[model samples]
Target chain A: MNDLMTRLELSALQDRYVSIIDNDRMEEWPTLFTEDCLYQIISKENEDLGLPAPIMHCDNARMLRDRVVALRNANIFEQPVYRHCLSGLEWTGDGADGYRCQTSYVVINTSAAGESTVFQAGRYLDHVVRTPDGLRFKSKRCVYDTSRVQTLLAYPI
Target chain B: MNDLMTRLELSALQDRYVSIIDNDRMEEWPTLFTEDCLYQIISKENEDLGLPAPIMHCDNARMLRDRVVALRNANIFEQPVYRHCLSGLEWTGDGADGYRCQTSYVVINTSAAGESTVFQAGRYLDHVVRTPDGLRFKSKRCVYDTSRVQTLLAYPI
Candidate 1:
C-alpha cells in the first residue's frame, strides 16, 4: 500500500481497537492481533527504568482471549463506560518487520452513576504487521504518565 | 483535494493547533481561524441541554486575538504546561459550509513542579475552510465532559 493508505489503514485499525474496547465488544478484541503477540500496559516510570513490570501483560492471542473471558466472568468490579481519545500517530519504521508506530491515547471512564473521569493518559508503542486479513498488531505497549490511577484498572487501556 | 489528502491535511492542522498551545505559541493561535470565526469551550451537559453557556467563547478573529492578549498579559493563575492528546478525526460535512470535522481530545497539565495530571477531556467540533493561508478553522467548538475542572483553566485546551 501507499504511504497515505498505510497511515489511513493503521489509523482505522487503532480506532477500531479502541472502539471495540469502549463499546464492550471484548470478544472481538483478540482478532485484531497476531497469534503470537505481546500486549502490555506498563507505567512510564517502570518502562523508563527498564523494570519490565507491567500493569497487565498478555503474550499470545489465547492469553488475550483468556483475559477477556476473565473480565467477563471471574473479574468483579464496578462496570464503567470507557471512551478512548487517541492522537499523534507516527509511523517510524517499515521493512521486513512491518511497521513500527506510536500514538498518544487518553481514556475516560464514566461510572454507572454517570460520573465521567479521566481514567488513563498514555501513549501506545506499537508494532503492526500486514496480514492476509489486514493489519494486525504484533506488539502493543501502553506507557502511562504517573499522576493518578484513581482506582483499580479492571479493563485494558 | 482528494479525501485522503484532505484528511491528512486536516489531521496535521489539528496537531499543529495543539502543538502551538502546548508549546506556548499563543500569538499564532488566532491565525489558525478565519477573519470571522467562532471558538467556544462548552460542557457536554450544557451542549446536550441546548444551553449556550460556555466557559470561554470568542467570535471573530479580533476576539480570539484579544483573548490571547488577556491570557498573556492580564490573566493571573498557575502557570501549567499543557499537552493535548487527540484522536478519531472525522470529516462530517463539506461544500460551501466548509468541512465540518470532529476529533476527541484530552489535555494533560504538568505543573512547574513537573507533576502531570489529566486536566480536561473533550472533543473538538470544527468547521474548516480552504483559504489563501491554506486551511483554517471557520468555527471550533470544544465540548468537554466535566467531572472535575481541577482548578482555574488558565490556558486554552
Candidate 2:
C-alpha cells in the first residue's frame, strides 16, 4: 500500500479496535490481533523494570479466550458503558510486514447508574499488519497515564 | 539531559509517584505536579474525539487541592489498597521545556483482607518539566486498557 493508504488503513484498524471495546463485546475484541501476538495491559510502574507480567498478558489465543471467559463469568465490576472518541491518528512508520501508528485520545466510562467518569486517557501504540483477512493487530500495547486505577478493570479498552 | 538520562529521570518520577499512591498518601501525590499543571484521569475510549470529560480534571493547583479535599471528605469507594508496578519507561520526545515520557505497567488492588486482583493495567503519558523542586508534571494523562471500570472512581488513579 502507498503511504496514504497505509495510514488510512491503520487509522481504521485503530478505530475498529476501540469500537469493539466501546460496544462491550469482549469476546470479539481479541480477534483483532494475530494468533501468537503478545497482548499486554502495561503500566509505567511495571514497564520500567522490563517486566513481562501485564495485568492481563496473553501470549497466545487460548489465554485471550480465558480472559473473555473470566470477564463474562467471574469478574464483578459495575456494569460499564464506554464511548471512544479518538483523534490525532498519526502514522509513525512502515515496514515490510506492517505499519506503525501512534494516536492519542480520551476514553470515557459511564456506569449503569448514569454517572460518567474518565476511565483513562492515553494513546494507542499499535502495530498493524496486512493479512488475508485484511488489517489486523500484530501487537497492541495500551499505555495508561494513571499509575493508580480507581478500581477493577473488567473489560478490554 | 541525554535521552538515556531523561528516561532514567522519568522512570524515577514514575516510581516516586507510584510510591505515594501505594502508601495511601493521597495528599502528597498531586504535589508531584506544577502549580499550572493539567491532571486528567481519562480512558482510551474517549481520547480520540477530545471531548470526553476527565474523571478528574484539575487545571491548576487550586482544583487539584479540591480533589484532595474531596478524597478526604466527600468521596467513597472501597477502602482499597493499591500496589503499583511500573515498567518500560521510554523517553518519547524532548523539548526546551520538558520531555514526554511513556511507561507501562500494572496496578493491583488489594482489599484489607489480603484478597488481591488486578485493578488496572495501563500507561502513563506524562509531560515532565524541570521545576525548581525537580521534575514536575505539566500534564499527566492516565489511560487504562479497559474501559469497564468497577463501581466508582472516587479515588485518584
Candidate 3:
C-alpha cells in the first residue's frame, strides 16, 4: 500500500468508484471497500430526528455485497441511472493505514425514459487506503443534506 | 490572535457564532468575519449550474455590516426565526492565517404565528482564522442541499 498518493490519484480513485455504479457493475462495488468497513447513506431529516438508520446501511464489505446482490437480483424499480459529479477533495488527515479526505458531490438520476433530475447533493467523508487492488475505501460515509429525496434511493449513494 | 486553536476551540467558536444569530444580535454578526471576507448562501441547484449569484452574497465585513443593518432596520418579513443544529465538524487543513473546516447544519424556522418547519439543511464550508477579536471567518460558503427554499432567505444561513 503506497502511503504517498497524490491528490490526482485520489481524485481518479473516486472517479473510478463512481464509474462502477454508473456502468452498472454493482457487484464489484463491495470490492471497493476493506473487508471490515462501513457504507451508509444518511438523510438530514432522519439525522435531525436522532434516528441512526440509513437508507443503505452496510456495516461491512459482506453486507455491501449483499446489497449489491439485492440491487442486481431482487429490488424492483424503474431503470434509473446515477451520474456523480465530485469536487472539493480536500485532505483532512492520515488514518492508521490510509488517508481521510472529504469531497462534495452531486448525484443526478436519469430515468429509463430519459428524464434527468438532480437526485441528491452531499459530501463524502472517506477513509481510503491503498490496497493490492488500488485505493480502497476503509470507510465511506455519504452525508446527504437533501431534506427530501424525490424517490426511494435504490442505488448506493 | 492565537494560531494554535485546538479542535474543540474551533468547534466552540462556530457554536458561539451561531448562537449570536439565534439570539437576535444581528449587529454583532459582522464581527465574525475578517475585514475582507466572502459570505454566500448557495443552493444545490445554483451550484450545479455553476452560477455565480448567491441568495445572499456579502463580499466583505462591510457588506456583512450593511446586511445586519438592513436586517435590523429595513428588511420586512413575518417574524421567522432560525434554529441551527450543526454536526460533522471536520478539519480539512490549516489556512494561511488559521484553519479550514467543514460542518453539516440543519436550520429549522419558527414563524411568529407559532408555526415551525425545517427551513433548510446544508453544510458550511468555512475558512476561519484567529483575529484580535477572536475567531473570524475569512470565507463562509453555506451549501444548502434542500430541493427548494420554502420562503425568502432573509437571514444569514
Candidate 4:
C-alpha cells in the first residue's frame, strides 16, 4: 500500500479498536491482537523501575481471553460508560510485519448516577498490521499518566 | 551518551518521577516539565473520538502547579499507600531535545487496613531531557488498560 493509504488504514484500525472497548465488547477485543502479543496496563510508579508485573499482563491471546473471563466473573466494580476521543495520530514508520502509530487520547467516564468524570487518562501505542480482512493489532500498550489510581481498573481502556 | 548510558539515565529519571509522586512531593513534580510542556492524563474511552479533554491537562508549568494545589486542598478520597513497580524499558529514539522511552508498570494500592490490591496497570510514554541539574520530564502520558476505574482519581498517576 501507498504511504497515504497505509496511514489511513492504520488510523481506521485504531478507531475500530477503540470502538470495541467503548462498546464493552470484551469478547472480541482479544481477537484484534496477534497471537504473541504483549498486552500491558502500567502505572507510572512501576514503569520507571523496569518491573514486569502488570495489573494485567498477557503474553498470548489465550491469556487475554482469560482476563476478559475474569473481569466478567471475578471482578466487581461500578460500571461506567466510556467515550474515547483520539487525536494526534502520527505514523512513526513501517516495521517488518506492521506499522507503528503513536496517538494521544482522552477517555471520559460517565456513571449511571449521572456523575461524569475523567476516570483514567493516557495514550495508545499501537503496533498494527494489514491483514487479509483488515488491519489488526500486533501489540497494544495502553500507557497511563496517573501514578496513583483511585481504585481497581475493571475494564480495558 | 551511548545507548546503555541513555537507558540507565532514562530509567533513573523515570524512577525519580515516581518517587516524587509516592512521596507526595507534588510541588516538585511540575518543575520536571519543560516550559512549553504538554501534560495529559487521558483514558482510552476518550481517545477514539479525538478529544482534548484530559482529567488534568496542563499546557504550561504553572498550570501543573495549580493542579497539584487543587488536588492537595480540594480533593477527598481514600488514603491509600501506593507502591510503584516499573520495568521493560524500551528506548524508541532520540528526539532533538530528549529521548523517547516507553516502559511498563503496575501499581499496588495498600489500604489503611493493610489490604493491598492492584490499583492500576499501564505504561508510561515519556519524553526525557537533560536539564542543568538532572534529567527531567518533557511530557509524560499514562494510559491504563482498564477504563472502569473504581472510585475517584484525585491525584496524579
Candidate 5:
C-alpha cells in the first residue's frame, strides 16, 4: 500500500486496540498482535535514561492473553472506564518487517461512581506491520510520565 | 566549530546544567538559559497526545529565577540531591543561528539520610544558541514518562 493507505490502516488498528478496553471487549485485545509480541508500559524516563525495567510487561502474545484472563478471573479493583485519547502520529522509520510510529496519548478514567481523573498520559512508541490479520503490532510501548496512576490499570490502555 | 565540536559543547553544557542542580547551586540554574526562554516539564504523552498541560513550566528567565527562589525560600519538601544522567543526544537540525537536539535522561534523588531513588526519567528536547553569554538554551522541554512520581517535584528535573 502507499504511505497514506498504510497510515490509515495503522490508525484503524490503534482505534480498534483501545476500543476493546474502553468497551470491555478484553478477550479480543490480543488478536491485534503478532503471535510473538511485546506490550510494555514503561516510564519515558527509564527508556530515555536506558533503564531496564517496566511497570508492566507482556513479553509475548501468551502473556497478554494471561493478563486478560487474570483481569477477568483473578484481579479485583474498582469499576471504571478508560477513554484513551491519542494523537501526534509521526513516522519514525521502517522496522525489520514493518513500520514504526510514535504517538502521544492520554487515558482518562471516570469513576463517576467515584471521581473523574486523568489516569495516564504518555507516548506510544509502536511497531506495526501488514499481517495476514491486517496491521498488527509487533511491539507497543506505552511510555507514560504520570508519576502516579489514579487507580490500578486493570485493562490495557 | 564542526559538528563534533558543536556536539561536545552541547554535551558539556548539559553536564554543567545538571551539576549545578546536584551541587545545591540552584540559584545559578537560570544563567544557563537565554533572557527570554521556555523551560517546561511535560509528559511525552501530553505532547504526542496533543494535550496542552505542563507538569512544570518556567516560561521565561524570570520564572526560572522565581522557581529557584521559591525552591530556596518558600516551598517545603524533602531535602534531597538530584544526579541527572543524560544520553541519546541527536542533533535535529540547525535553527536560526543555533541548533536543536533530543536527549534522554534520568534524575536520581538522594535524601541526606537515605539511599538514592530514581526521581524521574524522560527526554530533553532542547534548542541551543551561541549567545553573547556562550552556549545557552533558548528552550528546554523536559518530557518524561513515569506513570507516577516518587514525590512532589519541587525543583526543576
Candidate 6:
C-alpha cells in the first residue's frame, strides 16, 4: 500500500482499538494484536529515564487474555465510561520490518454521576505488522504523562 | 472531489486549526473562518438540554480578531502551552449546504513549571464551506464534556 493508504489503515486500526476499549468490548481487545506481542503502559518520566518500570505489561496473547479476564471477573472498581480522543499519526519504517508509529491520545472518564474528567493523557508507540487477518499490533506501548492516576486504572487506557 | 479526498482535506484543515491555537498564532486564527462566522464554547450538559448558554461566543471576524487582541494584551492569566489532540472526523450533507462535521478533541495544558494536565475534552461541531482560499469554517461549536474548566480559559482550545 501507498503511504497515505497505510496511514489511513493504521489510523483506522487505532480508532477501532480505542472504540473496543471505550465501548467495553474488552474481550476482543487482544485479537488486534499478534500472538507474540508486547503490550505495556509506562509513565513518561520512567520511559524518558530508560527505566523498564511498567504499570501494565503483557508479553504474549495468553497474558493479554488473562488481563481481560481479570478486568471482567476479578477486578473491582467503579464502572466509568471512557471516551478516547486521538491524533498526530506519524509512522516511520515500512511494511518489511513492520511500521513504527506514534499517536497522541487522551482518554476521558465519565463517572456514574455523569461528571466527566480527563483520565489519562499520553502518546502511543506502536509496532504494527500485516497479518492474514489484517493490520495488527506487534507491540503497543502507552507512555502516559499523567504522573498520578486519578483512580485505580482497572481498564485499559 | 471524492469523499476520501474531501475527508483528507477536511482533516488537514482541522489539524491546521488546532496547530495554530497550540502554537499561539492567535492573529491568524480569524483568517480560517468566514467573514461572518459563529464560534462558541458550550458545556455538553447545556448543549444537550438545548440551552443557548455559552462560556465564550463570538460572531463575525471582528469579534474573533478582538478576542485575539484581548488575549494578547488584556487577558490576565498564566501562559500555559496547549497541545490539542483530535480524532473522529465525520461529516454529512454536501457541498451545496456546506459540510457539517463533528470531531472529538482533547487539549492538554503544560504549565510553566512543567506539569501536564488534560485542560479540556470535547467535540467540535462545525459547518465548513469552500472559499477561494480554501476550506473555512462558517460555524464552529465546541461542546466540552469537562463541564467545569480547571482554570480561567484565556485562550482558545
Docking quality level of the chain pair in candidate 3: incorrect
Q: lDDT tens string, model 3, A39-141?
A: 9888767766879978878888988888777777877776455656567888755545678878888766655433445678998879988788877898898
Whole-model lDDT values for every prediction:
0.83, 0.70, 0.74, 0.70, 0.75, 0.85
Residue lDDT tens for model 2, A50-144: 77657756777777788889888986766566555466777665567677777775566555544445677666677778788888878777666
Report the Cα lDDT for residue B20, model 5: 93
Task: Please give the range of 10 consecutive residues that has the lowest summed lDDT in model 5 chain B.
Answer: B86-95
Error of 3 at A156 (Å): 7.4
Give the candidates in order of lDDT, highest first. Answer: 6, 1, 5, 3, 2, 4
Clashing pairs in 6: none
- Name model 1 segments beyond 4 Å from true: A16-106, A110-157
Which pairs clash inside model 1? A86-B86, A86-B87, A87-B86
Off by over 4 Å in 5: A1-157
Q: Please, what is the TM-score per model?
A: 0.66, 0.50, 0.57, 0.49, 0.51, 0.65
Ranking by TM-score: 1, 6, 3, 5, 2, 4
lDDT of 5 by residue, A1-157 (tens): 4565556556556656765665567899998889888899888788889897888888799998998889888866764655565577777455457888887776656553323346788988888877767778889999988867656766777
Under CAPRI classification, how is model 1 graded? incorrect
Docking class of 2: incorrect
Q: In candidate 5 chain A, what residue range of length 10 has the lowest lDDT sum? A: A108-117
Chain B TM-score in candidate 2, rounded to 2 decimals? 0.89
Q: Report fnat, model 5.
A: 0.00
- Report chain B TM per candidate: 0.94, 0.89, 0.90, 0.87, 0.93, 0.97
- Model 3 regions lying over 4 Å from their true place: A1-34, A37-59, A65-157, B1-5, B95-97
Correct interface contacts retained, every candidate: 0.20, 0.00, 0.00, 0.00, 0.00, 0.18
